[model samples]
Target: MTIDESALGFGSGARAVWASDPEKSRGRLHAEETSRTRSEFQRDRDRIIHTTAFRRLKHKTQVFVAHEGDHFRTRLTHTIEVAQIARALARALRIDEDLAEGVALVHDFGHTPFGHTGEDALDELLKDHGGFDHNAQSLRVVTQLERRYAAFDGLNLTWESLEGLVKHNGPLTDESGNGLDGPVPQPILDYCARQDLHIATFASLEAQVAAIADDIAYNTHDIDDGLRSGLLQLEMLEEVPFLCELLREVKDRYPELEQSRMIHEIMRRQITLMVEDVIAVAQAKLAHLKPRNADDIRSAGQAFARFSPDLQDADRSIKSFLYANLYRHPDVMRVREQAAGIVRDLFDAYVRDPSLMGGHWRTGVSGFDEAQICRRVADYLAGMTDNYAVKQHRTLFDRTPDLR
Candidate 1:
């Protein structure tokens, strides 16, 4: 159904009219019947949960490598955290919660085994080609890589799910199809050609919430993980004014509390403060924009679920601190270097002999040109778990780092 974008007061009720409505979704590429018990977005969430890619997240890296510690956040755990925050934001805005949750759950499907380090190596290696992009890879996974159903190659998700997945981070291009920030990835462009996800437009409010939720999850958890890894000290958190404030408040409230409990109190409060901030901002924006429907949100050319200027400053400060103290620490960089080498070595090996790849990956090589072959190899490699990549590298090469 075509929505009247010129209309107003759609959000007059307790919730937002700008929220994505699964019942009024744009529908899937491969049409299917409405579920008896679940909304379209709910079905999308279920499909994501059962994907092999989702299962692989358990062994994928977040900040630390998977083998570093048992308690550190893996991709799986991070996705769960993001989903929870997304749901909370969605519910507060009176949007469809399931779409937000589904977007959150599948957002990281494209990440490589060793995290951004692995992605960097692949992108460098594939530079002559279209280059490796986790976001594009995520779109590829949901639209093509998955092969569970008898009729379709991918999950054939509702159009709304696919749209949110691609545009969760905001508009990729302008109305002219020119890149808004940088060149749009080839896979995304190609997919949009077949079924336009309106790459130039901002995504639904539910997706906007999921995007910010990602930031909230990583910022807080990375600090938590950094402390546990000894790369970050509680004292070092003082560098970020937001964390410093939270720490000061907690300390003042419970001067004699144990270290662990004090940290927990800080983390929980951080989540609460951030979540509440976004909800308040979103409510006001919805009040101002008065979106007639979800499509009006896409046309608004910005996100509804935005943090205030102060929170945005805090967000950057936290990221900068993480980069300097945790992600870029000498010990972490050493591990990252080793991880990059593994990805590069495996890419070279596979490009030379496709047989090195397993199953359907090997068989598909003959139909594509050299560039296509490299991407296929990258796809297979990108799908590997950290341990699997290490093992495969050892099997093919004379040496491999223990990555401890």
Candidate 2:
């Protein structure tokens, strides 16, 4: 039952010096016997896939509601894509592929049912209660909330996994403890009280790859989804020079290709080009940094895995266009408005009548104060799938806003 050593980032399949060696892992909060069959990172990845949280992703929104269309990417599909791209980047950069894949898979665990719309609503509702950050919540899920182990309430993931979950994009605070991106989330700081993740430094290279893979994934897929939903078109895509060039190439190469195939072709090529750009940028940076070990990567201060300057500019252009065209489109915004209302209404309903949350969630709510109750409610609401949220809203209110 032993995994091929090569597959676990060892032997001939082993990566460069800076990869996070599972043998060197900082280990889990709740100590358990190591698996004889799997690398710690691989164990983390498998554990994530088996979690109730991961399974819920099947019905969670990525860009479109699950009921909007069958083929549009759900959170689960997007996560798989992110993991694929992340592994590619890790393989190319000679880092731990399993760790990268695991981070990518778990990155969106904290997102609410209706994508950003649900998150925005929840954040507002909990603002006085220390607010909510998906990154912090992600760490919370793995370290404090999964409740699978008898000895631990959470999954009790390794420190490296938890660190990547919390600080994949960058450090949460500065060297002087000032928040780098406004106030750091309370959940993260509270966790740090027991396990100092050194929030002032960069996460490992595996984490950085997962972070950029997210950028690469959503940028390409959202456009594809936007087109599928009729919220975006080829004509509008021409406004993005990067996309325009890619589209022009596709047209010139296969003028007679059908719309679906043409879009898929464009997406694959876009992913290839963006992934290559990241590899090149990271290699050049790594050459200069010459990190001897994983620790050196953290203290290096600046990000190593990055898009080149040109690619970064193109990334911004794509994001801006999506913001204007797809995200802000009147129809989409209307749906988002309704989605936000659902989240807000549900939070209030749960707070007013904790019994409405029934099951184990209800029995646990008795001793909580206002903030604690709100947080528990937020967690319950956040974990709901789009269909469940809609059902709950229908059960609570005589009328629900039609997302369509």
Candidate 3:
């Protein structure tokens, strides 16, 4: 018997009315002839995949440090998973898959070496100098760093891609053009001054899916990793009712299944349930909002793609559980302290003598002020992989943590 496409979450094969169209794109920052063979968003995805920052993700932290274990997910693997989910959701919603996937792939480019630990250390060290934000650093990476093309410094992605990357969570500003949560990062604000990304408006549907896909990917995988590392046990998951239910279902289906296979079964089912929930919720919102075009999605002032109210609670529950059991666990906290020390030591060493940074990073730093020097050092430091940061710390400081 044939199955209905709609039942499978393939909502009417035709493109949705509000889907982002490549031909109607907002174009790139630095103008160049469009590729004959690829859509604008495809080019954006391809360029991101080829960047040095993208390659560095392989050695960057996700939850566990990169060297923790080969089986654990790294930033690169997490990005790939996010991209896969984003693409699947985009296809189901009949939106722009390339744009969604591009956004997902590039979202974590700005993250420092040791996941949030490194970012926190850097932020505290530079608290006086606008602080460190991975999102802003991501924008800086694509727009100013990378230095690939002859005419342009960055990959020069399309405005849609850039907008999605910067506003992955949502609009950075409110109706009066004031930052909502706090001051918008200086790097993002500076870039918008040159090319208005309409930070006040919600991003396109493609971006919305990418952002939520990030939530889905990390929420599920971190638990998988935590379980693998023995930081989290199957019994601990009972704290969250949703996970408890999934665990019960898994056990019922395969009463004698081994722990590893049982965990994988639960993870795959969890992803499916979450993805379907997002698609259904988004589809319902789209029906109500009746957006006429991609711009309508941005100007709607609300995120269309998201988990339902119940699932939102579930999502929060999972995060709370992870934070308590895994992220803030004594063992993890110990490593975090060591990781933060490395970042702090490196920052001090670089700030004291820019020459310690070496090469072009040291070239013009002698003429710069304290803030300028710190920002430059941050740029160099943020680009490092987990191994590289540890190595650098070992070189400069008398002692270094093994990060085991």
Q: Cα lDDT of all candidates, in order?
A: 0.89, 0.90, 0.92
TM-score of every candidate: 0.96, 0.96, 0.97
lDDT of 3 by residue, 70-105 (tens): 999999999999999999999988998999999999
Residues 1-404, candidate 1, lDDT per residue (tens digit)? 11123332235344456778777899999889899999899999999999999999999999899888999999999999999999887876778889999999999999999999989999999999989899999999999998899989888988888889999999998878789878899999899888989988989988999999999999999999989888888999898889999999999999999988887899999999898888778777776788899999999877888888899999999999999999999999999999999999999999999998998999956878999899989999999999899999999999999886
Q: Model 1, residue 318: displacement in angstroms?
A: 0.7
Error of 1 at 133 (Å): 0.6
TM-score of 3: 0.97
Model 1 compared with the native: what TM-score?
Answer: 0.96
Q: In model 2, which runs have C-alpha deviations exceeding 4 angstroms?
A: 1-12
Root-mean-square deviation of every model: 4.3, 4.0, 2.2
